[model samples]
Target: MTAGPYPPSMIGLSDVPVSNLAPPTGALVALAVAQFAAISWLGRRCEPALATDRWRRFLDDGNAPLMTVYLWHLPAMVLLVGAGLLLPDLILPDAGLHWWLIRPLWLANCALILVVLTRLWHRFETVRLPALGTRTGPATALAGTGLAAASIWYLWQHGATLNGAGSAGRIAAVLALGCSLVLLACGQPRTRRDAPVRGPELNVHPVRSGPAA
Candidate 1:
């Protein structure tokens, strides 16, 4: 990481053209292969820890809000960096020894912001909305899913706000995405165990509730 092409000496990759990123050759290819091998070896060594309760819970909690973490990390960094611009006198250059010294401070700030963002939206990760289990529901869900995917693709390619123009397209995309979510929440399938039993003759189960009937 310290080997980056930073300031006073070289142009950063972000400033370079896409064509400049040539495919890996020779030593680079060997390095990539070695990384893969190392990862496989580490995974094998870590596998046994999964059986332990501590590791299991750690993995479970970390994974449950992973998408939230992934989505907000870059945004959090952007927010912090943008705020830093307000303190022009105190801010350091994008590279150099002084800038490198503050790297840990930047990472700490980003981590705090990410934690708050994750707390704000983590409930959505485990949300369970009731959905119809009928054939019609499945069809509607599929249609909505397709529409949502198309809208996301368009938005991703053209930016979410669209340079503050094409209000109609933006509105349509937002509406389509919202409708797709509704369709998904109200039309997704349910398994047999999720269905309620009906027209039963008797409550024969000894542990049945309802006034000890």
Candidate 2:
């Protein structure tokens, strides 16, 4: 779907030749616009229902652990798919007669794996953030992000191992990644012992009458 004009996408849903087709640029653009319009209309229609406290809580329940799901979902899928390779007999061929039947099983297994992963990592999404080791400026944060992105791009182009051709580059990339993490970990200001908030002494206090008035 991504390849433009000349090489309009030839990919299919599966090994099914019936599903093969190319999407024209005009069609893709029009479809995208249509989708946006539909979503806008739906959002407007749903706002009143969604504004209720019950719906808000429901939305929050689904959204609160979304980050955890986003982080672990790909890994969970990769692990399951890789593990499937070891049990080839259980997996059907693409577009095979039993493939459709097995799809639900695949989804169920992936969901089970995702649930376990969510249980393990979702706490990070819900937990209160801890203080940073040191306060950092935007420049530091930007530098860290650039370094981290560069490291990922570098390794994605070269290889991760430092045993071969691009060894030096890979090593540099790893170092960049480490430095980025250090910079990113430094945003929190150090806690002062004389801090003015967040305790019975600050947010809450009891008044005492002077010497029985």
Candidate 3:
């Protein structure tokens, strides 16, 4: 539901009906405040549990690879859903039948492909400047940041149109952008000879004679 000139599509998951009826401003404000308060209470209650070792590790592990999932999940889902739509008889299960058997396999397939792609593209997210003091370092970082931002914007704008001719191009562009960002941030790999070396230390100890003068 939406207020003013906005459509129900734009509002996303509202209590208001799909009809043209507009809720009062006071009611909208009250609902929003109530929602916020509920969220705050939930967060406070969950904080301690979320901070425990198990939860902490789960969050860390999930977060480490979440960027890859976020980046590729849409395309993967689109491809899978498109296939199911194109050949429903061959790919998708009948309504309310065999879904339990097919769903797990479908989910696993998606997860496997995503994991492979994530591994392949992981370097970009882990990019680190070899030397921040170098002129190239700052420039590379800036360029990488800009490219990453552009890729995100492109995805956000064109995500719904994944079935179009431009979908492959969009995927390729994002992949290239991610790789280029890594190259810029990481620079050239350092050789073994270039690694810092520590020289051996010399020690001197005074010797005492049998009978000191």
Candidate 4:
């Protein structure tokens, strides 16, 4: 999982001295901004009906199924992989598969997990929680929760290998996930209410009859 330089020992649980962790250039920031713009554009184009949406409104109205799906997918993949490892050799004989084919198997497992989770999500409507209060507050809370959880998981799983690139990727992924949660929270649908009608008085005008007379 380690990519790029900085040594494998630099990763893992070490009280390494603090140093400059900045990327080589401002390219990373520019890339992040570009990504955000692209995502915003795609959101508008894809969800035209919800174009005028706010993140808080979306979260409050209980329409964040994808967030749940994304959150659960990783764990599901881990479980599936573990189960696959335990399966009888006859069924999924590991005939010295190449690394390229192994990657495909991993992706297939992840996809299967997502499909199963999606079905479960549909059945329970767990994604549709009532808007608890102000959209910003709840959305922030959810983002914080997701970030904290992701951070803990990253440290636990890849703490030893968290070099510059890994750290950057982890931070980017967590931020993206947090933003998605916020968007989902803000994009909840509003409930419809009946509006009262006002009564009006009628006025009549008489036409001139000079020609007839």
Any idea what lDDT model 3 has?
A: 0.70
Candidate closer to the true structure by TM-score (higher is better), 1 or 2: 2
Ranking by TM-score: 2, 1, 3, 4
Candidate 1 residue pairs in clash (backbone atoms < 3 Å): none
Candidate scoring better on TM-score of 1 and 4: 1
- Model 4 worst lDDT window (10 residues): 16-25
lDDT of 1 by residue, 21-111 (tens): 2333344556579999999999899899777999889889889998989988888989898988997545646567878888898789999
Model 2: per-residue Cα lDDT over 145-192, one tens digit each? 999999998886565888777798899899989999989888856568
List candidate 2 segments past 4 Å from native.
Answer: 1-35, 137-146, 159-168, 187-213
> Looking at model 3, how many pairs of residues clash?
0
- Sorting all predicted structures by lDDT, with the top scorer first, yields 2, 1, 3, 4
Q: Cα lDDT of all candidates, in order?
A: 0.72, 0.78, 0.70, 0.60
Q: What is the lDDT of residue 129 in candidate 2?
A: 72
What does candidate 1 score on TM? 0.62
Candidate 4 Cα outliers beyond 4 Å, as residue runs = 1-31, 40-64, 87-97, 125-213
TM-score of 4: 0.36
lDDT of 1: 0.72
Highest TM-score: give the candidate number: 2
Show model 3 residue runs off by greater than 4 Å. 1-5, 8-39, 85-116, 123-213
Q: List, in order, the clash count of every candidate structure.
A: 0, 1, 0, 15
Q: Give the range where candidate 3 is weakest over 10 consecutive residues by summed lDDT.
A: 10-19
